[model samples]
Target: MTNDKKRWLILILLAFISALLLAITSTAISIYLYGNKTYTAKAEAAIVLGAAVWGEEPSPVFRERINHAINLYQNQQINKIIFTGGVGEPNEAAEAIIGKNYALARQVKLNDILTETESRTTYQNLKNARSVADNSKLNKFLIVSDPLHMKRAVLMARNLDMDAYPSPTPTTRYSSLRSQIEFLIRETFFYFVYLVFQI
Candidate 1:
């Protein structure tokens, strides 16, 4: 109403906007830095998160994630591998089943392979994986994915009350700055959305 009051209101609004921007920027930086990191924490199972499966085969990204999990399994860092993804189209193999088969072919023991074949998104993946983990009396999980996807994937896992650790693939498909930043920004956005709006 008054000039001084209007000036104070404008100042407060600017400060609020500035704070939000700073928070968002800080989170983005954290996500970017953390995504590039690899964890050494051992867990009961490595959750190989799903990516595109080309018909009956895994896409490059999915293969990298599965290979990383395979290495963990071979190194005895994890006792089991839980692959998560469901059928995306008619006649398409569910990603979890395809990933399990790949690991089996690569010599991962048959008894150590598990699948959650109903998840279509990251949240659903972890959500359903948690159920499988619960049924098996397993609590700790190593979340395997592309380096750029580790943060949110771990967030979802921990949010589901699992002892979750990050195990991002060392060789990621996002090999360029443009691809890296694009994924970083995208994951950061989803991370904030999940933090603010979901458990």
Candidate 2:
């Protein structure tokens, strides 16, 4: 190849290698962070980040999150529960509202169920949850979600200045190594993007 073409090829090769290395490194770091179980004592509320709702019911993944929050409430670790999720469909109930109804049916009182039905994404969930918590003086929060999701969720919580504890569900559908790895990779990419561009 010509000298100019040879140099261009070398640079492109190096760039590709660098990108690959970064992806591997970030994925490893994300897996580590995803398993981290951060918590605090005497929290005022347990914030259940919203997930998909099947029809008018919380989806299995979302139910797992709500169950954890309910466990916290039962143990008195948190005084109240704040459910965050907006409606995904035009006529379906908001995720938070659906979760609240579920909790109430499970014997959690309506008075202690706080709903933030204006957020549909994780970032929005925490932002809207923080607003609801602040209005009710439930400042400290135990954030509940799938284990692999806590890393980014906690990062966003910190950015929003919310006193959030990363309390991931004890078990989730992403239990297999393959599923876990997939989630880790996706989270790493998004986390990196969020860090670099604040998107």
Candidate 3:
């Protein structure tokens, strides 16, 4: 190729890379900021996204989400709790069931809790929760999860046409700066991927 043509191509490539980086950086900032905010509005139910389950108990990360939902229920911000997750292995207990059991042990009434035990992903979580909501005549929902996970979760909920709001857990397992940064990076990439599929 000619010198001028080669130079122009390089410049174009550089510009494209720069723009992509800027977009990603801006998304990370937005996710970080948005996740940090918590919604306290009243809703029909608090949809708790599942995390890890340690045997029969909830993992620390999962416990926080369930605790946040219980708080919402106790505060009268929500009337029902919906837990969503399937088992990680074929014969293991589902994450949703584990969360429900945890809440029950903590005195959340059995009649007030619902579990969707077939979802293995965030998208599946909200999607399956929507079905439970429909059956129960629950309309609005507070989407509860870890702080850094709220942005993507809420976006997916909205995309599913759910009347959803963010309700991030104030206390998160990702407490250290290093852990938070790592979560932000992971969320940033997933958020961008979600946006792309949305388009």
Q: Across residues 82-124, which tens digit of lDDT does each residue of candidate 3 receive?
A: 9999998766799999998889998999999999999988999
Tens digits of lDDT, candidate 2, 96-197? 999999999899988898989999788999999988888998778888988888888888998999887788898677888898888887877877787787
lDDT tens digits by residue: candidate 1, 1-199: 9999999999999999999999989988988788777779788999989899998889999999999999999999999999999998889999999999999999999989889999999999999999998889888888999877888888888878889989889988888999988988888889888988884
Output the number of the TM-score-best candidate: 3
- Compute each candidate's TM-score over C-alphas: 0.92, 0.89, 0.97
lDDT against the true structure, each candidate: 0.90, 0.86, 0.92
* Candidate 3: worst-modelled 10 consecutive residues by lDDT: 190-199
Tell me, by lDDT, which candidate is best. 3
TM-score, candidate 2, is: 0.89
For residue 86, give model 2's deviation from the true position in Å: 0.5
**CA RMSD of each candidate after superposition:** 1.7, 2.2, 1.2
